[model samples]
Target chain A: MAPSIVVRDVLDREAVRRSVDTALADFLAAKARTATSQPQLGYLSGLLQDFMAGGKRIRPLLCATGWYAVGGGEDPRSVFQVAACLEMFHAFALIHDDVMDNSDTRRGRPTVHRTLAEHSAGRRGEEELERFAHSAAVLLGDLALTWSDELLHEAGLTPVQLGAVLPLLNEMRTELMVGQFLDLDATGGLTDDIEATLNVNRYKTAKYTIERPLHIGAAIAGAGAEAMAAFTAFALPLGEAFQLRDDLLGIYGDPGTTGKSRLDDLRAGKNTTLTALALRGADAAQTARLRSSLGNPLLDERGAADVREIFEATGARATVERMIDERHRQALAALEDSPFPFAPDALAALEEIAHLATVRNS
Target chain B: MAPSIVVRDVLDREAVRRSVDTALADFLAAKARTATSQPQLGYLSGLLQDFMAGGKRIRPLLCATGWYAVGGGEDPRSVFQVAACLEMFHAFALIHDDVMDNSDTRRGRPTVHRTLAEHSAGRRGEEELERFAHSAAVLLGDLALTWSDELLHEAGLTPVQLGAVLPLLNEMRTELMVGQFLDLDATGGLTDDIEATLNVNRYKTAKYTIERPLHIGAAIAGAGAEAMAAFTAFALPLGEAFQLRDDLLGIYGDPGTTGKSRLDDLRAGKNTTLTALALRGADAAQTARLRSSLGNPLLDERGAADVREIFEATGARATVERMIDERHRQALAALEDSPFPFAPDALAALEEIAHLATVRNS
Candidate 1:
């Protein structure tokens, strides 16, 4: 076996991001070349390439960090390919998610469906155009997912690694869908079930956005049960903090800073834990106002301000802040409690991520 | 190496169907068990199981026949699981397609979106419920796709077999999406481009429904290039004939026999080869009537009767029938010209499928 590399050097965030981006660009470019027989396919590859350009690459970063923390036993080329696969999969999720929410913008640009609707301009009436745009976006999302599978296959994982990682990958996908279903089920109805909201959060973010990516990277490195369990312990709490902070950013962050409208979640009637906690403690009139205003399709900035005021008045905002702080602490403690002698730099990298996840504005 | 199994007994349609169905049921059962923490997951599993029960298993049958025709070198158990994966993938495609078309009935029962809408009734008003149903159905399709991947991974193919099959499987999915995009782009507009209609048919049916499944199954058995070329030559025309037959059934067949509303294609203004041919040969007034009546959301049986009359008057129906006949003949001819020594019973089976495909009413 080769000597273990220093974790921080292996997981240099800038290097990983550049490497993964290059892999994705090269892969899509090859797809475009192969699509020359059907030139229209080149348009799809271009759209996907542009849409993928602006993401933070958070999942890929975590995947690389996980691989490095497990001692980077495998060829970094394969790891980079898998990381690129995660990025493509994230693109798939976001495209479908924007359509499901009828979102108009993502990453400060028109959403995929919106762009398709514009592309389809002058071809149909309003209703037909809307239908075409939505359906076409769904198809695009499906293609991205299939392409993600292709990247994973082309990653050249050994059979044993492929076998180990596939189950976790499938579980991660299924769990995200389940979380989405539950979220859809809960929308349009105000609820005070904080525990239920937390369950959704855990499934949607805690496992999907964090634990599974880490586990997949570790599995690729042939990490054993003890190391895997350690990752679970470290990832779950940190992941929850990640989502809770996202909810906070959705409502309270500056649009210039976050590149998202603070009012969209409130307008969409998202039943986040913060909202549930506020509903739990609200007086009758507050509850009535929330029920009428939260899910209104035309909710404006004034409406959002009112909702935020209620959140503050009920102490939901402060309570959530406390929760994030506690989870962040728990996540850092998990690294200290890990079974393996984790490299000093790996521990520091995770600690920094925990801080950024909980304390940052975006 | 062990002696090869007899092809005919291995591909006994009844035995293949029963085994594939059992694999699907067992897989779903295990999924249900794993979802004990969220009982709603069990409901999704049950809905999928029920939706899967009524299909003709055409793809799985073709796949099993492909493997058997290649001499059944591997364990039949693994082949059956992969066949089941194709069926589940088909389920995913159908569920999303139905949502796109907004169809109410399939296989003599309410579509997945309809069932979900009915299940979600009493919780919201009409429009919200409709949106919820559509979104949830899309999520369900995503789940089915994920589960299909799980099934493929669990099939226990060697690394080489997996490597060979993955690219074909990915290509199959991408081709289907491309065809779907083209079909969506062409809908709501009448056209006389016969070649364009055939292009869609080649991608959507010839490749997706026929060629890829055969290639995947043959790849699993380590079949040589000559055998694969033969499968393609035999599959493409046969698949085209099958789709052409489907077009005929969509317009003229009995609802009782076909289990589909004969008027849907006309109502949706689907630009099939039949419609293209009809438009190509129609006089001015006849063309005007088609433009006005077709794609009218309120198109009824009376309008459909007029369309059918025009189809007959323009000889489009006859032309389509002739096309199916020619393609069916070409398919049989290709089988007869195979480079390898094919099993006698396998040739007979291909002939039977060709006949059933071109001559069927439903």
Candidate 2:
């Protein structure tokens, strides 16, 4: 029997998410089917599928929105496929990030390395098995990266579209790596350099998470230079606001709602703008407490509470909230002044996205 | 004054290596120049440059050869750039492999992780420093992988050339990853499954090292089906023989000549065909001795001697030699009966590569 058809509106967030999910599922299914001789590939593909199921697909949503913002063409199939590629690339980034952070859980479940280690419980010594799991997870991340490229190549884009998109995609990948390196270099060291933290955010989040996705989608729709610049203006501030919300949530959000441990960022000694601002405003004793509590592997709930109290006492928390508000306003202003003349539905969708990104708890 | 021009012949192995090296150096130099704002990138690029200087450049040479074998066009610049891309990809693979194996050295120098760890000395505790180094090395490897793609995208190939090469490149990447997974899955265990070991060899070495590179170059030259098939037939057996020679060198070659510790493969208990054959032909006591010595981290020179004796006594070493000989002969036979009409110089170069690959001491 033929399947029931679901008419997907590009402006409908739920529909966009569902469409991207379907595209991703179909792509992975083909991969798994073709990997009959390599059973490990089938197994890895399943792992990736399960891992992907929990994502919010924010990048894909932005991509589709950006396409529409630039007066996208009739067919949305290739747009959806490219969106799936971005999601796959994200999976690669996250899998490697977890390995680097030595994180145990993601999305309220064991991380990829932890899952693999658990799967091989009795097959080898604990240490050996853990090492193997880490190595295998790295390989899996590489595969995801490779497959992301494959998805884009097979996304049915015309030569002109491919040509336009490839350079931006390359830039995005390199920028993310640069951001990751900066983040890694800054880890384990407490700093009061708010500008440096924002620099990291600009590359890691502003460009990678928001701007590039928008550019890629717009480019697919044959966006002009003015439209691309408009995307950057709208994207950068909103992306920063999104990350600021994420940092606050990392320390304050409810575990059940966020599906993440509040302590992970603190435990990793992440030098977020919030922490940097807090350090900048801290008194001597508060600074000492911040230094000891952050990046401590054995940091307890009591320690985190101490940190939150210090953040409040130093006015860092208030400052970050203010910063998020300012950025959100800037993003909206860009959209209002946009020279590209976005359609009414696209404009509405982008406004909603900017609002949700800035104010969301999770 | 103009620089002195050196005439380059693709069939000349040394000239091909030089051209590929020059291409890679130029690429990395451009990357370094562009990364002025990101100083870490410049530093990482320098590290990669040093790492690359030590490679054999075999893959690039073979790629160039394959291009010529199928009647290449006049301009060799794009071929060299693509060859550089392959070499860069190899760097990514080797960097990750060293991390997975926890190897200390490559080409008589510290491995990337070890070098990074040493560089970070005195900045952190030993364990933390080691962890950071490994993570950083993974990121660096990722950069290499990303840069490899950039190299290909910027290689100035016609759309038709790119269309021909991309699928083969993708398949090569996937094949390498699959081979790596299989090899990782088999580490730390001694098995008597000769066929299984050869399966790993076929993927890890045969296709990745030889066949796919040839296919990519041949595709760039728009090789007909008959020529592509002939390259595969010549490649598979020759690749297998090359790896078999490498296996012997890993266990028996002098450290001075091979620039690798002879004890590493034995200590890792690699499930090579030679080891598998030895297990298959071993007596009970010999088998027990083999099991104990192989994969033992503390295996010493005396223990290695014992394993070597077992290999000799069971004729496994001899059988591997015979296998290498047979494979080498088969590759030559395929070349002799090649369906594509090869130029005399190209045919001569392929024969030389085959002979040197199977019989080289290093």
Candidate 3:
């Protein structure tokens, strides 16, 4: 059987996000019912529900658009289920990331571990409470990962669809984990390796955030080799651009708008592409300043301002902005050259998402 | 086609164990080759290989026995692959369990987190290295869980077999996580609730180690309701007995034979059935001594002896042994009334396992 051509229609991003949210809500509610026998499970499910309520649903949007790009039509239920699965997987990733980074807040609220620790204040000694909170968060993350698989299994895919999708999903999970390891290894050790930093970004963000979700959705619709290639062509550049914009925002975005502290990346000494570039370009005095200022747990606003000045003086900020613009343009060109004849709806959505990702303050 | 009768031959327990180990080795070796691009993954794989070399292979044994109990034969390759998947999942569980318990050692070797900390000692400050090790071990556990799923996917099962097995796998994972949460919540608080402690043992050990693996293997062979009921009737009681033996060993077993410190459980204030029973039977002075001694991180050899005296005086030790014998008897009776007529080989192997699990000093 020949693959069907993609259909053209104006993409409704808001509508897609709403449908994905409803799928997540309905799925979690069902989980709540199943967890009635284990009362403690209710607390975890509630925390996960609260954590998920604040997501922008970018991956789900990409997934829905991907299905549309491959001529998928008729019932939208399966696609929505798979899209919600991605969101749940993201929650797992973020919760673990917060614990690893020892961050106190996420999305402008206390992080999962912090909230748990506070709740147990009267029950445990200070040191023991902190340990309990950390372990509980880790377990919760494990549950999210496990439940994400449940969502996929219950999505009602045919055997052929599952066979096509499982390998890609496995590969995506491994790549993300490996990327995290690289990121963890690089932390607290300042490096001037631009290529290495970019490599981490490619694995952690480019392939994971963009390519895999699109590929998974297209696979669900039985898209062929040419369509898959087109997705990679569009996804890699846009995903890299997305991370680059994130790096910029980490140092520059307003906390109220971004729902994250601007000082976090600096304080944690995250080895991002911008930092690598700046370190490579800095003079001896500037290098010493970066070395001393970064990774200081007690870094204050004055120290942060000095670090920002050095970053600007080294031209890192401008260079990153240029990188984002270049990748965004390349992504748009890839979309234009898609082999699927009726991919205009996907193209429109991709263009809008590209703008939102690269130009946003958050 | 009629369901084939289970064939009778005294099972080669050692041969099944060897095949499962080979499958695990080959799968992890392939993963090592695939992970060459990310050098850091090789270290994790190496650590995991070392960690796995010392395991008792209990769950894999049960999985294979379950298959044989339901007429599986003549091509052991797929069964071995699935059995290895169970072992890998157990590794994930143990690695995370160690991290949560803040354990310093396991199987007479440094725990994963402790080893990771020592490895990073040269690169980070003492406190910083400890935190890094904890986070890294958590990530490694996540990797182990993800790779276990990959093993299941690549096991080359037919679609029908996969459909039968996936739900059992999901349920097993969820049950284990809930069990962990319950255990975590009850730690460090003295409780006289024997039922609650037993509940933790049932979910954490019985369902996870015995029932689910059997159910998964039985499902692979398309066992009917009667066969499933027989397996559960036997599994639950035997599983509880296995854990009860473990609780006794934790306090009474020799360190040289067990390859674990006897005082670890008492010092951690574990709410085992034995401890709960002792607390219930203790007099006022005995209760005060129990509270002061248990969970004392610095509790030395003398303090441990005192705790042991209290356990004996309160009759907790003898009671736990009685519980084990009762459950063992029930499991054997259930086996005697097997619904599958040709399950003699499985029954023989299971009986031997029960003896080893209950009577061994280690």
TM-scores for all candidates: the values are 0.97, 0.97, 0.95
Interface RMSD for model 2 amounts to: 0.9
Q: How high is the lDDT of residue A299 in model 3?
A: 85
Over 4 Å off in model 3, which ranges?
A: A1-10, A338-342, B1-10, B339-342
Return the candidate ranking by lDDT, descending: 2, 1, 3
Worst 10 residues of 2 chain A by lDDT: A1-10
Q: Which pairs in model 2 have colliding backbones?
A: none
lDDT of 1 by residue, A1-362 (tens): 12332344346777777788888998999888988666668888899999998888878877887887888774677777898999999899999999999998888788999999999899899999999999999988988998999999889898888888888899888898899899999987878999999999999899999899888888888888888899899999999999999999999998877768888899888999999999999999999888878888899989889989999999999999999989998998899999877899888877877787788876
**Model 1: DockQ against the native?**
0.77
What docking tier does model 2 reach? medium
Q: CAPRI verdict on model 1?
A: medium
TM-score of predicted structure 1: 0.97
Q: For model 3, what is the error of residue A74's alpha carbon versus the real structure, in angstroms, after optimal superposition?
A: 2.1
Instruction: Using DockQ as the measure, name the better of candidate 2 and candidate 3.
Output: 3
The per-residue C-alpha lDDT of model 1 at residue B9 equals 43
Please state the error at residue A214 of candidate 3 in Å. Answer: 0.8
Q: Estimate, for each residue in B1-362, the C-alpha lDDT of model 3 and write its tens digit.
A: 11221233215666667777887888778778887677777788888888888888888878877878888766656767788888988898989999998888788788889989888889987877887888888888988898888889888888888888998999899899999988988987878999999999989999898888888877777878888888899888888988998888888888777767888888888999999999999999999999999999899999999999999999999999999999989888888887666456677887887787677787
Best candidate (score: TM-score) = 1
**Which whole-number lDDT from 0 to 100 does residue B203 have in model 3?**
90
Q: Across residues A72-150, which tens digit of lDDT does each residue of candidate 3 receive?
A: 7776678878988899999999999999999987888888999889878899988788888998999999999999998
Please provide, for model 2 over B129-192, each residue's C-alpha lDDT reduced to its tens digit, 9 standing for 90 to 100: 8888999899989989988998898888998999999999998998899899999888866789
